[model samples]
Target: MINFKIRYTLLLFAACISLQACKKAWQDHTAITIEALNKTLIQQINETPDLSTFSTYLVKTGYDKVLASSKSYTVWAPTNTAMQTIDAAILADTAKLRLFVANHISYQEYFTTAPNPSLVIRTLSGKNIIFTPATFEEAKIVKGNVYVKNGVLHTIDQASGTKQNAYEFMMSTGLSTKQRGFIQSLFHTEIDTSKGVKLYTDPITKKTIYQAGTTFPVTKNTYFQRVSDISSEDSLLTYIILSDVAYDAEKAKIGRYYNLSTSATKTDTLTQFAVVKDLVVNHVYTIDNLPDTLTTVSGVKIHLDRSAIIQTQKLSNGIAYVVSSIGYQILQNKIPVIYIQGELPDSVRVPSTLSIRTKKDLNDVKYTDMQSRSITSSPDPLYYYRYKTTVNSAQYKVYWRAVNDIFTTSFNQKVDFSATRYYPKAVETPLATMGYKAVAVSDYSEVYLGLYTPANYGTLYTFLVSATGVVSTAPSALSLDYIKLVPVN
Candidate 1:
C-alpha cells in the first residue's frame, strides 16, 4: 500500500512538470510563428482596407514584382484617401501608371538613413523625385517603419512629383522647349568609325602598330540623335539658355548676316549658325552650380544675369539656367580670328611699295608719315588687322606671321602690343614685348607674342600690334599677315 501511494504521487508530479514544459514550449513556438507572419509591402497593402485602392492599382499596374523582390527599397506609399485625387485616366494608362508608381517607390531605404532629410532620389522611371521627411511629417507618416523581408515601408498622407530634372523641366515649358538646341549642345558626343585600319604610334616605344581594318562598316555621327539623348549621370553639366525673346533677338542678328531659308538644316553654316553655336556652347559649363560667370568649352565667358533668370532646373548630373540675355551683344570677327595674307580687306591692307618715313612731332616724340599707307605710324604703331576677343583670364597666347626681308641684313626689333588690361591693375600697358626674326618672303615666321593678357571684363578685347624700331633702316621691310590669340587657362 505504501509503494502504490509513492508511485502514484511521483506519476502525478511528473505529469505536472511535463505540462509546464509543454506550456513554455508552446509560448516560444507561438511567438516565432507570429514573427514569420509579419506583413510585407504587398501584404500590408492588401491587408489594410484603406490601402485597397493603392494595392489594386499596384496589382493592375503589375508593380507587385518590385515589392516581391528581396532587394531593399523604401516606398512612399500614398493612402487610398490621398490617392483619390489622382486622375483615373492616369492610372488606366499602363505607361503612366508604371511611371507614377515608380515615382513613389525609391530604390533605397530612407526612413532610417538618408543623405539628406530632403534627399533627391532617382526612381526606376529615370526621373528624380524628392523625398522630404519634414514635408511628409506635415501630412503625417500614417504608417511608419514597417519592416519586411526586403525593406522598410512607410505610408504617407500624400506625395507627388515636386521637381523636374534639367532635361525634364526643359521639356515642360514651350518657351524652354524651343531652347532644346542649347541643351543638346551641352551633352553631345560624336562616335566615328573609319573604313580603314588605324595606324597608331606608341609614344613610349616609338613604334607603329596597325590594327585590323575597321573599314568594313562605317558609323557616322548624327546631330538629331545627340539632341534626343541628352542626359548622362556620369558627367555633370550646367547650361544657360537664352529666353525665347533673347533667342529670337539673337537669331535676328544672325539673319542680318546670312540669308535664312526654311530648307537650311541645323548643320548649315548660315551666318547665324556660328553665332548660335557659340551662344549655345558658351552656355555649357562643366560645373553643377551657376556662378556669376562661367567658361564655355570654346573658352568664352558666360555672364549670368541672376536677376533676369527666367527659369532654373536641376538634374541628376547638372543644372540649367534660363536668362533673358547673356549680358553682352553677339559680335563677329571675335576672339580666335585667323587672318590670311591672301585674304586681306582693303581697309587694313598695307601696300608693299610704301616705304615708311619717321618724323619728329613738336613734343620730340618720333612719328611716322603713314599718310598714304594704311598702317598707323606712332611710337606705338597699329597694324591694319584687328581681332576682338573676350578676356576671361589673365593671359592669352598670341601667334603671328612675319615675313623676313630677303636682300637686307636682319635687325632685331621689340614688338609690343596694346590690349585692354583688366587684372592686377586696370590700365592700358604695353603687352609684353616678344621677338620675331623676319624671314625671307619665300618663307614665313610663326612666333608668339609672349605677354598678351587682357583684363576686359567679358567685353570685346582688341589686340593692336605696335613695333618700336626705325622703319627706314635696313631689313625693315616686314609684312604682317595674321595674329591669333588663344586663351590660356
Candidate 2:
C-alpha cells in the first residue's frame, strides 16, 4: 500500500509540471500574436512606401505624437499620387496643413465589410466627413482591413472636401416669402401691430374702408431645410436653380397684375398658386440611375435638357445643376384646390357667435381667441360671419354646413350665402334642416372671381345670411359653422 501511494504522488507531480509547460507555451503564442498586431498609425505609415508623402505631412503638422498615444482612430491615408497633387501653399500654411491632415483621419476604424454603405464620420478637426461606399468596379479598396493597436486603416482613391450641396447653396443665399408661401398658404399674410387701420377710398361708392396691419412674423419651412441638408445620405439629389434675372422675369410675367410685395387682399388680383408651382415645382430634379428625365421630390417632372444646364456643381453626395429658365405650361383644367380656414388672420366675422367649430370636428363648438374676429358669450342677434379672401384662381366654390339643435325651430330660415353680390352662386338651397347638410354656393359650375391679369389679385367676399334677398343687416338669429374654398378652372 505504501509503494502504491509513492507512485501515485510521483505521477501527480509529473502531471502538474506538464500542465504548467502547456500553459506557458499558450501564453507565449498569444504574446507573439499580439506583438505582431501591435503597430501605431505613425509606425504603419512610416513602414509603407506609398504613404511616405502623407507621413511627411503628418510630421510637419505634429500629428504624429497624437497617433502614437493610446487613442483609437481610423486613418484614410492618401495614396502617393493623391498626396503629390496637394497644393504647396497648403504645406506652407501651418493651420491649413493641420486641417488638411485632420480631415483625412477619423475617430474610429471602418472596414469595408458592408456593401454600398454611407457614413458621416467626425474627424480630429471637428469637421464631418461623409464616407461614401463604392463597388469594386468604381474603385478598389486598396490595403483594407489593416488592424493596428489604436484602430483600423483603409486606403481610397480620393477624399472629399467640406463643400456645400446644391440645396445648401440656395438656402445660404436666402429665400423670399413669395417663394416659401406657395407650399404653406399661412405665410401669405402677416400681422403688423404698428399700423392699426389705413383708410382707402372706394372708387365706385366713394366710401372709405379700413385696412388692417400688413407685417408677418419670420418663419422657416422644415421640408425645404431637410431637402437641403448636406448630411442627408439616404438618397442623392440634383437641384437646379433659376438665376436672379430669370426668376424676376418669370415672376413679372406671371404676377404682372398681382402685387406680390404688398399684402394680398380681395381688391388685389393675384395669380396665387400658378406662378409659384411653375417656378418651384419644375426646378428640382432627382438622380436615380442617371435617367434623362427625372421627377422631383414634389412629383414634378423635369427634362435633363443639356442646353438648359447652364451651371453645374459637383457636390459630395449629389450634383447642383442650374438652369436659365423653367418650362411652365399653364393647364387651365388642372388647377389645385385651395382651402382657407375660418380662423385665418385675413378673415373677419361680425356679430360673432360665442362658440366656434372646426371642419375637422363639427359636433364640438369651442370658444376661440382669434384676431380680427368678434367673440360673444352667447349667440348674438343679426349674427353673421363675413370673410374676404384673395384668390389666384379666377373661379372658386364655397362649401358650408348647416347644423340643427334643440333650437332647430328658431333656426328655420334658409342660410343664404349668395344674398350679396360679393358671393355669387349657381345652386342655392333653403336652410330649414334639423340635421346637417353641405351647401355649394357659386354663380356658375365654375364660378368666376376677379382676375389678376386684368384686375388686381381677384378680390372676393363670402358672407352668411339668415333670410333670402335680404340686403344690409337685419335682426336675425343664426349659426355660421365653417366655410371652405375649392378652386375651379
Candidate 3:
C-alpha cells in the first residue's frame, strides 16, 4: 500500500456522482422536491420463497430498517433471477447471506427519477459505485426550476470492485459439484514448476481459470499467479507469479500432510534425513499444498529457523530450513525466467562499447541471462535480476542467450545481450547517465536476519555510461540508492 490518502478522495468523488444523479423533484402538486425512490420502497423482502434472497439479507442484518429511514441509499438491486441463481444452501446460511448482499449497498442518496446516464456514487457501505452507459431524461430535472430531492435511484448493470479474489474451487479431481469450503483463504496462488505452467479453476465463477507461464489478471487480494504441486511427478520447483498479498499461512493452520513416496499414513511428521532433503529443500513449502483427494503422507514440513528450533551446526534429522525471506530463496540450479511484456516503440541498439564491472571483495556476480524482451518500455522493470554474490574467492560466469521469463538456469561466460534491449530509451548516443542500479551484496543468503553478516555489506547503485550498455571508464562517479551493512550471526 502506498500509505497515501489517495483513495479517500476517490471515495468522496464517487459519492458525489451517485448522489447528484437523481435530483429531487416536486410534482406540480407538491412545492418541495422530494426523493422519488421513497415511492418504490422495498415493500416486502421474503427470504422464505426467495423472490430476492439479498432483500432477506438486508432484513436479517437489520439494514432493512436502516434503508427505511430518511437516510438515502443507492442499492445495486440484483433482480429476482440473479437472487434465485444463488445456491439454495448458501442462501439458507445466515452468515454467507449477510456478506453476499450487504456488501452491495451504498448510502448516497439516489432518487428513482434521476435521469443522469452515467454517474459514480458512494455506497452506504462506503464502496464507490460507478454507473456507466446510462442516461438522464425526465428523471431528475437539471439546473434551476428544481433544487433536487434528497435522493434518487438509477439502475446499473455492474457493481465495481466485487470480490474478484473469491476462490470458488471451480474444478479439481474428486471435488463434487456440491461446494466444499473455499480453499480456506488461498495464500500465494502461483508456483514455479518443472512441468511447465500449471492452472486451477476458480470454484465460483467456474469459467475463469488461472494459468501460469504468464501474468494472470490479478483478482482480489489473493492474486492467483501460479500453482506448484509437490504431489506431482516433478516436485523440485515451486511456482510463483505475483501473490495478491503477503499470505499469513501460519495462523491459517492450513495444508495437508506431506506426500512422501514411502508413507501410508496421511499425517506423519517425521522421516529420515535422506528422505527429508530429497522430498523437500529448496522448494517453497506452503499451507495450500493439500489436495482434495487423499494421499499418503510422511514427515512434517520442518521449519528450522530461530522461531522454530534452536540454531546449531548439527545437521537436522530433517532437512527443512526456514529463512526470513518468503518462498524459495536460493535454487542450486535456478530457472532463469524472463518475459518481455511490452517494449519501447524504437529498436534498442546497444553501443558497441560495453564494460562489465565485477565488484571487488564480492565473490560471485549473478546476473542470470540477458533478455531482450518487452515488459514496460524499460527492460529492467520487465525482469527481476538477482545477483547471488558469494563472500570472496569465487569465480562468476555469465553468457548471453535468449531466455523466457526464467533466467537463472544456464551460464556461459561469453554472452550475447544483443537480443536484449536496454531499458529507459535504449542509449544510442554516447551517454553519461543511464540510471541503472544494482544491489552489490556479498551474498543474497546473508540478507536474512540471523544468516546475515558484516561481510555481507553491499551497495545499491546506478551507473553512468555511453549509449551502449557499459559503465563509462572515464567520465563519472557511481550513484548509489543506499549502501547497507548486513551482519550474520
Candidate 4:
C-alpha cells in the first residue's frame, strides 16, 4: 500500500509540472504572434531579405523614421536586384537620393484590391506615379498588399527612374534658354502669414497680425498663377517650349497690340508674356495621339507642325515638346475684337444732358443706350459722345447698334477718330457723306460704319457726332447702343 501511494503522488506531481510547462509555451507563442502583428512598414522592409537594398537606401536618406511614424504610407520597395540598376550619380547626391526614395512612397495606404483599376498617385517627392493592380509605373509588382501596422508594403521587380516635371524641365539650363530665363525671372517671394503664428489683432482694422519673424517666405511665379501650373502633379498638361527663333517670330506678330510703351524693354517683356501665356494646353497629347491643332487654355488655337519638333520629353506631370516653329494666325487668334459700350464711355460731352436708357432688344437681351436730351437750335452744339481706348496700328471696320424705338423722326450720326482728345483733325475719313441715318421706326440692327485706320499703336479718341443745328425731342436725338471695332488683318 505504501509503494502504491508513493507512485500515485509522483504521477500527480509530474502531471502538474507538464501542465505548467504547456501554459508557459502557449503564453510565449501568443506574445511573439502579437509582436509580428505590431511590426511597422520600416520593420517589415528591414526584415525582408529581397528589400534589403531599398532598406539601406531608406536608412541613408533618413526616411526610415518617416516610415516608422504613425502616419499611414504605401511603400513600393524595389528588390535587391532592381536597386542595382539605379544610377550611381543619384545615390551620390543627397538631394537626388532623397527624391528618388520619396518617389516610391505615397501618403495613404494603397492595396491591390482598390476600387479603381488605375490611379495617378502623387508621391512624397511631388512627382506622380501611375499605380495599377499589376504595376507601379513601369515596374511590375512582385508582391503587394503586405499590410503593416502603419501602412502597406509592396515589392517591385524594378525601380522607376525619376523624371522631371514640366516646370523642372524648363528650369534646366541650355534647354529653351530664352523661355526658361523669362520664367525664372518671374520668380518672387512673399510672406506667408498662414505659416506664422498670430501676434495680435489690430484694433483699428480688426485684422489679425502675425508675428513678423515667424512668417515664412513663399516663392511665387506669376506664370504659374496666371498661366498653367506646370509644377502641379494633380493634372496632366501639354507644354510647348518655343525655340528662340520661333519665340521671336511669334512675339513680333503679337507685339502690335502690346506696343503701349515706347520703351523697347517694356514692349519685349509684354510681348514675351503674351507669347508664352498660351503655350501650355490642359491635356497630355503623346506624339502618336497629337492632333494637327491644339487649343490652349487661354483659348488660342495654334497649328502644331510635327516636323518642327526639336525634342520631346515625357514628364512626370505632363509632356513637353520643344518646337522650332509654331504658327498663329494674326487676325483670327492673336487679335480680338473690341466692343465699346456706349453707356460706359471713358468721357462724355455734356454728361448732365445725356440720358442712358436701359431696354431689351428683340432677342430679349438687356442693353443700355446713350441718347442726347438737348433741344437747342444752336448750330453744332458740340453734342458728341466721346470714347477713349488703346488701339493697334491696324485698320478696323466699325459697326454700331442704335435702337430708335422712342424716336419718331430719323436722325443722322457720324464717328471720328483722333490721337488726342481735341475736336477735329480726323485720323480717317468719316463713314458716309451724310453720315448714318437712324430709322424713323424701331430698329435694333447694327449699321455698318466705314473702315478707319489708326496712325500708330496708342490711345485713340472716338467722337460720335450728331447732326448740326436741330431742335430735338426723343425723336431726332442722338442715340447709340454699342459700337464694335472689328480688326482687319
Best prediction by lDDT: 4
Candidate 4, residues 160-228, lDDT tens digits: the string is: 877788988878735588888888888899778877889889999998899778888899999998998
Against the true structure, what is each candidate's TM-score?
Answer: 0.49, 0.53, 0.27, 0.75
How far off is residue 27 in model 3, in Å? 18
Model 2's number of clashes is 14
Candidate 1, which ten residues in sequence have the lowest lDDT sum? 369-378
- lDDT (tens digit, per residue) of candidate 3 on 209-231: 44555444332322222222222
For model 2, residues 1-489, the per-residue Cα lDDT tens digits are: 999999999999999999998899545422212331579988987888888888888898989888787988878787787677677787788997898888778776665553246565567765545554431212345556577898766665654344454445554543333333333543233344354465777999986555644433545544344333333433455665565555555566555434444555521323444333332222324443345655554444545566665666654345665566665332222233444343442333345434454333333435222221222221323334455555453344545433433232323222222213333333442221122222232111222222122123444444444432233132333344445455443
Better of 2 and 3 by lDDT: 2
Ranking by TM-score: 4, 2, 1, 3
lDDT of 1 at 44: 62
Give the Cα-based TM-score of candidate 1 against the true structure: 0.49
Using TM-score as the measure, the top candidate is: 4
Would you give me the overall lDDT of model 1? 0.52
Candidate 1 lDDT, 1-489, residue by residue in tens: 999999999999999999998899545422212231356678766777877877877888788877877777767778888888887777777888887777777776666334365655676666665456434423456565566666667677875533354555566666654466554444434333344466888999986555665534433223224222234433445656667887766665544333333434432334333344444332335344456656554455656667777776655545676778775433322234333231232233233444434545345655332212222232333333333433432356766654333345443333333344321121445454455444344334467756555443243333333233454334233344445556443
